[model samples]
Target: MNTKRLSNQGGESQHQMTARFTNKVVLVTGGGSGIGRSTALAFAREGATVVAAGRREEPLAETVKLIEARGGQGSAIVADVTRGDDVVRLVETVVARHGGLHIAFNNAGVLGTPQRIGDVDEATWSEVIAINLTGVWLSMKHEIAHMSRNGGGAIINMASIFGVHKSAPMYGAYAATKAAVSALTRTAAREYIAQGIRINAVSPGPIEAPMSLRPGETEAQRAERYRETVPLGRIGLAEEVAAAVLWLASPESSFIVGHDLVIDGGVTI
Candidate 1:
């Protein structure tokens, strides 16, 4: 098994992380940065051959480079989840190159312009729904088709705390899409579990990422907001969220299905 010490993403410094995904092939979307990058590295450190996919190649390449530096194996694939053709090709390429896909983290998403429901532009609304909602569906559509017939797999869709419990007024577009993702996760889980494809979701709030910060807000302001809102008194780390994704994708969560695991520092509690 491949072992490595992961750092820089909020964790115990340079501790050895054992392999939990030996001989598995994992695919991570939106893996160029933030939570996606962290999850991709985690998978690699745990002995999975990771394929990091995103619309951009540079950031994905950086993710691969980090994984390699940690003595893990990874590769970058450029694909936009918002496009059906891209998603299809993305899945095919991963399987073709890696032999088979045993796990997937559909984490690609966008935070559309935050505005009052009535004031949000059509373009912004459409983009949010397309990338955040439709994109996940497209990813599952292909992944399910592949995993069902290829001995099954685990799929973790990235949801949000906004969808599971609370929502601010201007976050309508993003919130709606996330809520839909939760519903979609349940529906897909029911449809695919019999075939051995275990589907689940991870709903996070105020993680260390650009999307969690509000417009015109500084990092300090965002930190203060989390203190007021999150019961844990701080924003979550990408590595923390990545740990949840890895659990959902691992055999440790074998009986878990259609569950939306919320990692919001007790904000929803």
Candidate 2:
């Protein structure tokens, strides 16, 4: 088992973490940065042999480097989730290279430039749907195929509070896709649970990421906004969300399927 001390991400530090995923293989899409990267590291810390997948190779490699530094096994695989061929090849490659994919975090998504439903351009809407919604579906389509036949696995998709809990004006494109993702996750969960696959989602609010900031909003400004609006008095951390992701993927959550776990610091309440 690989053990490591995880640093605090805008919250208390974990002095030591247990190896809950020893001998397991985890595949994390969008594992290049923010919540994705944090979740990748969190899985590695718990002893999963992690495969960090993204379109960009450099950032994915950097994530693997961090995992290695903590004495965990990890590698980077470049693939665009929107491409069916890429998604298929990615799942095959992980299984070919890593033995088996025990868990998957389908976290690839984009926050399309904020626009009202009536004002959104075709390109903007298409891009958001392609990446945020289509990408997840494609990833899951292949993942479920493999897991269902080969002793099943847990799958976690990324959703957001804006769609699942509260929708803001001028963010129609993103909200629509996320709400759709939640719907897909719930439907697919029931469809595949009989086959041993557990599907779930995490809907996060204002985490400490670039996507959380509004246009022309500074970090301090965003912080202040959340401080005033969120009941927790601040935005959530990437690690905080990552922790939830890991739990959803862990054995502890064996019975939690079709559930959208919200981690928004009470803003959605």
Candidate 3:
């Protein structure tokens, strides 16, 4: 008989467990800034090689710098998620370099011109739908194909709190697209769970990010409104949302499938 005793130092064991992602390959869209950026860095810190993709090269490069600064492997790829061809090439490049794609954070998004349903034009509506909803579908389409080739993988779509519940007035398009994302996530999860792929979504509330606030709105106005609406009495940080995404991507969430993990500061309640 063979016997082994557990280590007495829990801290060391915790560090070892947290490094569970060592050598895994992860691809993050919109990884240049905000929640995506934080998630990318968090994955790298846990020992995964990161592929950060985005429209701008500068922010992507900055993310790579942070990853490298922490002694993790990282590379940047510039691509627009709204284009099918771009998404295809993005996955292809990751496979070419990393051999396989194990995890993906489909986080790229845009807040299309906010206009009432009566005043919004067809072009604006189409554009918002293209990026917010279709973009996620396209990325998942290619990501699933690649991951299937390698047995299995995990995918986390960046949905919003609006995906579960609607916000009235001018947010018609944004809310609709996010709700579509939730439906899409469930569909993908059902279709692929048998094939070893796990798909889930992280719906965040009004998080504090550059993209969350309008350009002309003053901080005071935004803060006052957010405080009133959020039960936590404050807006959420990008890192807080990133933590939820990390859980979805890890093995710890193996039993969770097709679920929208809401991180809304109790606003929905």
Candidate 4:
């Protein structure tokens, strides 16, 4: 059991030691910022040669820089998760660069503008579904293909507590995609577990990430709202979410399969 904390932000990340993922090849999508960035750095700290992917190259580069600053090895790749060809190439590139992809965190996602189902625009709905639901599927498609052929691997997809246990009025579209992600994760886990591919999801709520803040809402306001809304009296940290991802990707969770771990600070309870 690896007990090393892998949080990558605030003041606590200065300490480092490699454990569960040493010499492993890990891939993180949406790794340009927030949970993705934190998770990528955490994996690197564990001795995994991480590949951070996002649509933007600049953020990806910065994530790599942070990993290097921590004496960890990582690289950045700009690839949109919504495109199948790009996903295929992303997996190929990781395998070609680091030998093989042993772990993958499909954390890329988008939250369209909040609107009632009757008032939401079609384009917004489509984009959210494309990036959130379809994107995860595409990533797993290529990732499982490579991992199954080479050896067993672990996957962690990003979902939301809203999608799994509750529903919000303006967040219907976003929640739908996340619910689909949870369903897809369970189905895929069953399909590929026999082949040594373990699949799971992390469904978080009101984390310290861009997606948690409402439009025009400041961090202070969001914090206060979390106090009132969440049973834990606070929002979750991106590093906290990252730690969950790292655990799911590690052998520590070898017996856990098809489980959508909720890290929502009791929001569902």
- Residues 1-269, candidate 1, lDDT per residue (tens digit)? 11112325434444245678989999999999999998998998888999999999999999999888877889999998999999999999999999999999999999887689999989999999999999999999999999999899999999998996887578899999999999999999999999999999999977978787777999788878887877887778788899999999988989999999999889888
Q: C-alpha displacement of 204 in model 4, angstroms?
A: 0.3
How well is each residue in 1-107 modelled by candidate 3, as lDDT tens digits? 01011211122332232476887999999999988988888788788999999999999999999788767789999999899999999999999998889999999
- Counting clashing residue pairs in each candidate, in order, gives 0, 0, 0, 0
Predicted structure 4, TM vs. truth: 0.95
lDDT of 1 at 103: 97
Summed over model 1, clashes come to: 0
Estimated TM-score per prediction? 0.94, 0.94, 0.90, 0.95
Best by TM-score: 4
lDDT of 4 at 157: 96
Location of the lowest summed lDDT over 10 successive residues in candidate 2 = 1-10
lDDT of 4 by residue, 1-269 (tens): 11123322534544375766888999999999999998998898888899999999999999999899888899998999999999989999999888999999999998888789999888899999999999999999999999899878999999988787788779889999999999999999999999999999999887988888888999889889998988888778888899899999887888999999999889888
Model 1 lDDT-worst window of ten: 1-10
Pairs in clash, predicted candidate 3? none
> lDDT per residue, candidate 2, 238-262, as tens digits?
8888999999998899889999999
**Candidate 4 deviation (Cα RMSD):** 3.1
